[model samples]
Target chain A: MFYLLDLLGTLAFAISGVLTAMNKKMDPFGVFVIAFVTAVGGGTLRDVLIGRTPVGWMLDLNYVYTIIASFILAVIFRKKLEKLRKSLFLFDTIGLGVFTLIGLEKGLDTNLHPIICIALGTMTACFGGVIRDILCNDIPVIFRKEVYATICILGGTVFFALLELNLPINIVYLLTPAVIIIARLLAVYYKLSLPSLERK
Target chain B: MFYLLDLLGTLAFAISGVLTAMNKKMDPFGVFVIAFVTAVGGGTLRDVLIGRTPVGWMLDLNYVYTIIASFILAVIFRKKLEKLRKSLFLFDTIGLGVFTLIGLEKGLDTNLHPIICIALGTMTACFGGVIRDILCNDIPVIFRKEVYATICILGGTVFFALLELNLPINIVYLLTPAVIIIARLLAVYYKLSLPSLERK
Candidate 1:
């Protein structure tokens, strides 16, 4: 089940990357590279930090296949995909939730400090888009104006709190992702965001 | 000698990052983070790719200290340092040369393909600045213009070719970095760059 969620998250992230690259007028090679980075960049960082080298995508060919599939789908249905803003947003949120939990769990497994685990979760769920935006020559939306990473941190906190309650491990995993997804979806729905400093 | 060169490279990269962040008007924390990233980002990426976990910086605190020292020096003498542009350029170029060789040697140690090793050399020497530019909300200068990474690639190719000739190991090491430094310095001196696509 976790594997399926991981794959789903990867596909969603890849599609998001493709859409962003397309909007940026990147060439085909650039689009594919961006998609691959978006799908796996966060996990790769996490794996590297924790000494889990050879990384997740390298260990499994599924991620590459999924990114390729996503790139093809996005290209074929560019117009249609653009029109499905709500669905795209949903997929992105779900993907963030799963990815964050995966990172949190990985950090936990490494016996890292709880604060570090939360940071790892946030970094894992968000840095892919950060990297993608960097490659596209734009300030990352999360860093500029979004409640995105904050939501991941919050979800991580909840995850650890629930774990401390002696909750079933499986239930904790399920609940953690659910919390992230719901938090993200609500933030989007409410147009919630962190305040930006305005220049005089 | 190699260890000293590595430390110097880290300090130079950190100084460059500090200067960039200062121009961006970031807070001290942000400046430190950027400096840290610029000093270690390339090697971190290379290490991660080659399955060296915990990364170089995490294992040794010297990098951290060097970055801190660079950051402090950059902050204190920001105006005076700006006047030392030529010296700074030389330091940066030398740093790039040594970093590229370190990456190439690491890749070769892992028995990676020659092309991959060359690419690793280029990435290790260049990606720090790329990441810095990205955080500064600019397209990486390397990708947009200059013969920067190309020099590293050229140097890597030369390193391998010389190895095939069975040159003394010490001479080969010295010669590879010398080639990179000279190529980069010449490129800058001549204002030589790859041809950029002109818009119609």
Candidate 2:
């Protein structure tokens, strides 16, 4: 089930990249590169940090095949997608929850400090999007004291805390994404923001 | 003396980044970020790979300050820069030479295999420019079989070979850049290029 979520998340992210490149009128080659980067950039960084060899996509050709498939799908359905923006949002939101959990799990498996795990989770959820925006030459929306990464950090914390409380494993798994999606949705709808500290 | 070379390299790289942002017509804040990233991105990757704590720029506020100063200088001279096409290229070459040496030295300090050190050197010399292009939404020239990174790898190999031959330290330092510059000039003049694998 978790692996399926991971694959879905990769697909959604690749389509997001394809959409952005299409908006920019990029060539097919450029669109493919952006889609690949958006889907795998964060995991590659996580693997590099953990000293995992050959990177995630390099080891699992499925990830590569999925991104390519999604890019082709995006191209064919370009006009149809305009009416499905809301559905695309659903996929993106789910991807955020799944990737965050995967990141936190990987960090725990490596026996890293819990704080670092939370950081990794937040990065896994957001950095690919950030890289996409950066490449698109815009100010990253998540950087401006937004509730973006904070949502993932808080959600990961809730997951581990519940596990310590001896919550049922099945309950914990279900609750994790539920909590994150609700938080993120609220943050986006009402512009819930983190306060910035004044530089002195 | 070694510290001076390092400083010169940092300055040159920071300037190249500033120039890139200028070409994009970015504001002062954007220029500062581009400059900082170009100056330290490669070394930060190297340190992270080696598990070094507090990558060099984070440890030294001076590097950060230097980038800021360079950005200010770039802004003041933006008009002059706009009139000159080759200013960025000149600094980029110097930056590559200095980065190659620093990367080679750092790898030697860690006692990595010679071939790995050469890889490190080429990565250090070229990766920053690759990143700058990516952020600017240009195709990464490195992935295109350009002569750019190859020059750094060739010169790096020469550095180690000369060291083993017991050449004078000054001669080694001077000879490395000369080789890189001459090779780069020849390649550019002759329109040398790696054959691109035919696109499928």
Candidate 3:
């Protein structure tokens, strides 16, 4: 079940990456590269930070195939996607939640501190967009805009809190991603964002 | 000896990152973060790709100390450095050479493809600066302005070619970094750069 969620999250991230690359007028190769980077960059970073070798995508060739498939799909359905902002946002939010849970679980498996695990979760959820923006020569959207990473951290905290309360492992895992998905959807629907610091 | 060289390279990269952050008017935390990222980003990426766990800096806290020292030195000597562009360039070039050699050696140890090794060498030499530029919200300097990564690739090719010739390992290591350093210094002196791709 988690594997399915992981695959969907990869596809969602890849589509977002390809769309961003297309908007930036990158070439086909550039589009594919950016899409691949965005799809795996966050997980890759989490693995590196926690001393996991070969990373997730490297361990499984399935991710490469998934990214390629997503790229082709996005390119073909470009116009339809352009008219489906809500759907795109939904996929992205689902991606954010699933990836966060995966990262938090990986960190826990490594026996890292809970706070570090929460941070790892946030990084996994948002770093792909950070990388995409950086590659496109813009300030990272997370640093300047929405409460994206903030929500991930909050959800991660809740994940640990419930675990501490001796909830069933299965229930805790299920609720964590759900909390993140709900929080993100609500944030987007309400147009809620962190305030940007003004230049003095 | 190699350890000392590694530390020097880290210091040079950190200084360059701190200076760049200062020029961009970043806060102290921002400066420190950027410096730390720039000092370690390339090696971290290379290590992750090659399945090296814990990364170099994480396993060795000495890098952290070197970066902190470099940051303090860069800030105190910031005014003097503005007048010593030549010296800064020299340190950066030396860093490029040493880091490239280190990366190439690491790749060879992993028995990767020669071309991939060359790419790793180039990445190790220049990617820190690439990350720095990305975080500072600019197109990568090497991508548009300099022949930096190219020089590292050339040096790596030379390193492997020399190895194929059955040259002494000591001589091979010495010549590889020398080739990169000299090539970089000459490129800067001649103001040579790759031509930018024009939009059609």
The stretch of ten residues in a row with the least summed lDDT in candidate 1 chain A is A191-200
TM-score, chain A only, candidate 3, equals 0.96
Could you estimate the TM-score for every candidate? Answer: 0.60, 0.57, 0.60
Q: A92, model 1: CA deviation in Å? A: 16
Which tens-of-lDDT digit does each residue in B1-200 have in candidate 3? 86787788888899889877776766554576579879988998898778786567655678888998998888777777777777767777778999999889889899998999998988888898888888989778889878888899899999999999999999999999999989987887898898889998
Residue clash pairs of candidate 3? none
The 10-residue segment of model 1 chain B with minimum total lDDT is B24-33
**Weakest 10 consecutive residues of candidate 3 chain A by summed lDDT:** A191-200
DockQ scores of the candidates:
0.16, 0.06, 0.14
Q: How well is each residue in B1-200 modelled by candidate 1, as lDDT tens digits?
A: 88888888888899888877766666554566578779888988888778776667755768777887898888778778868887778888889999999999989899999999998898899999887887888878998887999999999999999999999989999999999999887888899999888897
Query: Ten residues in a row with the worst lDDT in model 2 chain B?
Result: B24-33
Off by over 4 Å in 3: A1-44, A48-129, A132-137, A141-200, B197-200
Please provide, for model 1 over A1-200, each residue's C-alpha lDDT reduced to its tens digit, 9 standing for 90 to 100. 77887888888899999989999899999999999998899888788777986788887999899899989999899889868777777778888999999888887787776766876798799889878988888756675567888899899999989989999999998999999999988888899876542111
- Over A1-200, each residue of candidate 2 has an lDDT whose tens digit, in order, gives 87777888898999999999889888999899889888888877676666666778998899999999999999999999888787777777888888888888777887766656765677788778767787677655454445667788789899889889999988887888789988888888997775432111
lDDT tens readout by residue for model 3, A85-110:
77767777888889999888987887
lDDT of model number 2: 0.77
